[model samples]
Target: MRIQSTKQLPSLNELKEILSQRFSGQYSVKTFGAGRKSILVGKSTLIGAEISIHKNEVSIASSPPSVFGGILMTLGMTELALFIFPFFFKHKSGYRTLEREIGLFLQHQYC
Candidate 1:
C-alpha cells in the first residue's frame, strides 16, 4: 500500500517514531538513497518489511504470512455458487494490517 502527501509528509524522524511505535518487538532501519528499509524482530525471528519513502508517497510491503478468504456474495454469484460450492478457497501472503495503521497515522499527522 502507498500513502501520498504533497506538502505535509511526515519527516523522517516522525516516520521512524511512528513505525517504531506501531510494530511489536525490536526493529532496525537502514537508509539507502531516498528510502529506508526496516527489519523487525520478535523473539529472535526476523519480520522482514520494505518501506520506501518517496517525495510524494510512501510504499509498504511486509514479509509475514497472510490468509485471505473472499467470496462474491452478489445475487448472481450466490446463485452460481450453489452449484459450485466447493470453489471457495483461501490464499496466503504477507501481512498488510500495518499499512492501514500507518496510513491512518500519516493522514492524521500531515493531512
Candidate 2:
C-alpha cells in the first residue's frame, strides 16, 4: 500500500490504522528525523518513507541488513555456546530430550 501526502501526511495513529489493515498485525509506527523523513514499523522492523522529502510520497521496502546483523550480535557468545555445547559434548540424560524441548518451544512461539 502507498500513501502520497501533499502536506506532511497524517498523524501516526492514522498511519497505523492503514498499515494494520494492510499488514494484518499489531504494529507500532513512528516517524523519525527533523522532517519526519522516515517511517518505522517496529513489530517487523520494516521501514517505509519517501525518497525525497520534497516529494511527500512514500514507498515500502525491505529492511536493512544491519537490523538482522545487530540481532545476531546481541545474541552474544553464551547463547551460541549453549546451542553448540550440547552437540559437541555427550550428555548422560540424552540429547534428544533437550532437542525436543527446544523444538517444541520454538514451534509454539512462531506458529
Candidate 3:
C-alpha cells in the first residue's frame, strides 16, 4: 500500500525511531540507508513488511506467509479445532492493520 501526502515526510532516522518505539518489541524493525526498511512481526521469517519512502509517498509491501510458515501456523491453530478458520481471518486482518498504521504514522509525522 502507498500513502501519498502533501506534507513533507520525516527523515529516515526519525522514521526508524518512531516505528521502533511504536512496535515496542512486538515486531522487529530495521532500516537501511536511503529510505528502506524491513519489519519482522513474528517468529515466522516470512511474515513482514518492506517499506520505502520517496518524496510525498510511503510504500508498504507485505509478503504472504511462506508455505512452511502457513503449515506451521495451521498446525498451531488446529488445537482450536472448529475455531481455526476465524484465526486465519484475524491474522490477515491484523497484518493489514499493521500496514495501515505504519503508513498513517509516516503520513502524519513531521521531519
TM-score top scorer? 3
Which regions of candidate 1 are displaced past 4 Å? 21-48, 64-94
Candidate 3 lDDT trough over 10 residues, lowest sum: 35-44
Model 1 lDDT tens row, 19-88: 6675536444433333334422121122334566678777766532111122232322566867655533
Question: Which candidate leads the pack in lDDT?
Answer: 3
How many pairs of residues collide in each model?
0, 0, 0
Please tell me which model should have the higher lDDT, number 2 or number 3: 3
Shift in Å, residue 91, candidate 2: 31
Q: lDDT, candidate 3, residue 85?
A: 65
lDDT tens readout by residue for model 2, 1-111? 233554554454465455445445443445544766655543332222211222454444333223563354345345685665553344323333433332343233323
**What TM-score, to 2 decimals, does candidate 3 have?**
0.56
- For each candidate in turn, the TM-score is 0.45, 0.31, 0.56
lDDT of each: 0.47, 0.40, 0.63
Candidate 2: misplaced stretches above 4 Å? 1-25, 45-56, 64-111
lDDT of 3: 0.63
